[model samples]
Target: MQPTHRSRRILRPVRIWFVYLSLCVALLLSYVPTGQVPGVPDWVALLLAFWCVRERQHVGMGAGFIFGVLVDIGYGAAMGQHALAYVLLAYAANAVSRRVLWFTPLQQSIQILPLLLGAQLVMVVVRMLAGAEFPGWGYFLSSVTGTLLWLPLHFVLLLPQYQPEERDNNRPI
Candidate 1:
């Protein structure tokens, strides 16, 4: 007989302040100009999706909109481009949060690729409508990069919430 293993860890409740703080950090990271860099992930959108999935109640469309707008202002892109993209990303993430949580981080990243792509697609379409030329295929690489970062980012973000590994004899988990 094979010994059964626990696939999931019980996590402490996430602090609301930490969530916003991490988002702010991501916002700051995005402000750094990586000139001509291909496959540089959209840090704000990536972190927003992570929070949307992990803490759906605390982070959702409203947070998405605010950060998206900030990203727009920082990038000097057309207003509402990233905002619409992020709002849609949040909704999609929320809708799939439960299902995505059932999988490992690698699997979750695969599942989330579409959501990331959809968000990018929204921005592309909005930009085109605003008379901007197509940004070319390389623009989509950010979504792929974000997907690749998902596994590590998952462990890092959840590290604080992981319960102590030592088993206590007095208390039943």
Candidate 2:
């Protein structure tokens, strides 16, 4: 049976702040570095990647540049450091978003790992160009950590918008 207009609208839960809140959480986490590695997982990059994969139209390279600038300022790193990296990351995520979104979050985690690594790689390359000392292989660990965190982050961010399971009244005998 087709859902009524009201039910249809109800089923399509869309909260604008859900995206902003996720960004805010990532922004805050960026300031709170954690991990046994030399670099912290790029929280904002991961967040941006998830949104790009989940909802491309709503988030894109522009969003990445904006947040990337914020991170650059917050960390007092080189200007456009994260900006360039994030733009590339979002662009990459958006590139394969179609195929990636079709998979489960766990699968997405695996697929997006390299993109996450690429973002970190971009950042490292930028820092290196700016004459910053190499942080060693430990720096790359953030990608793995970020990839592992993707499933949890995806579920938690989507939790608020999740609809209750519909009754299977149309089940066949």
Candidate 3:
């Protein structure tokens, strides 16, 4: 006898408040002193990318621009540097969200790596244009770290939306 596979259940829609709260947390994380350390992922960028992919309709360039501006203020970076990077990130994430949702988190991370890298590249270019010296290649380590973290972040973010697994014999779902 062949084993039959069960279809995956649809996840509950993500709440808008929860998404904004998570982004706020990400902002706080980025504000931590350790953020200057090599390989410390850009928490705001990572979280923003995740939401852009999962809830493009609800969270996109607006959230990106707002949080990006906040980040710029927090870092005292050139105004709109992070904002531009994040807006582009949101757009790219939304553009590919459908295809990304079709993959496992591991595979999704691989796809997201380039998007993260591109955002970082945009920041670097902005800094250079503002007459800042190159921060060096180590700066990109954040994207790598963020990519490595994608799997766990994926599970954590989705946890609240998962429905209970108990079978309800009384109801047809």
Q: At residue 154, give the lDDT of candidate 1.
A: 92
Pairs of colliding residues, candidate 2 = none
Candidate 2 local Cα displacement, residue 52, angstroms: 0.6
| lDDT for position 3 in model 1 | 30
lDDT of 2 by residue, 1-173 (tens): 75342222232354767887888899998987554545467889999999888888888999999999999999899999999999999999999999997677788899999999899889999999999988789889889988889878876887766555554668421
Q: What's the distance in Å from true for residue 69, model 2?
A: 0.5
Clashes in predicted model 3 = 0
Per-model TM-score on C-alpha atoms: 0.91, 0.84, 0.90
Query: Which window of 10 residues has the lowest lDDT sum in candidate 3?
Result: 1-10
Q: Candidate 1, residues 1-173: lDDT per residue as tens digits? A: 53344344578888788899999999999999998798999998899999999999999999999999999999999999999999999999999999998877889999989999999999999999999999999999999999999999998988877766576898665
Worst 10 residues of 2 by lDDT: 3-12
lDDT of every model, 2 decimals: 0.92, 0.85, 0.92
Sorted by TM-score (best first), the order is 1, 3, 2
Off by over 4 Å in 3: 1-7, 164-173
User: Candidate 1: where are CA atoms >4 Å away?
Assistant: 1-8, 163-173
- Superposed Cα deviation of residue 1, candidate 1 (Å): 10
**What's model 1's lDDT at 49?**
95
- Per-candidate Cα RMSD to the true structure, in Å, reads 2.6, 6.0, 3.0
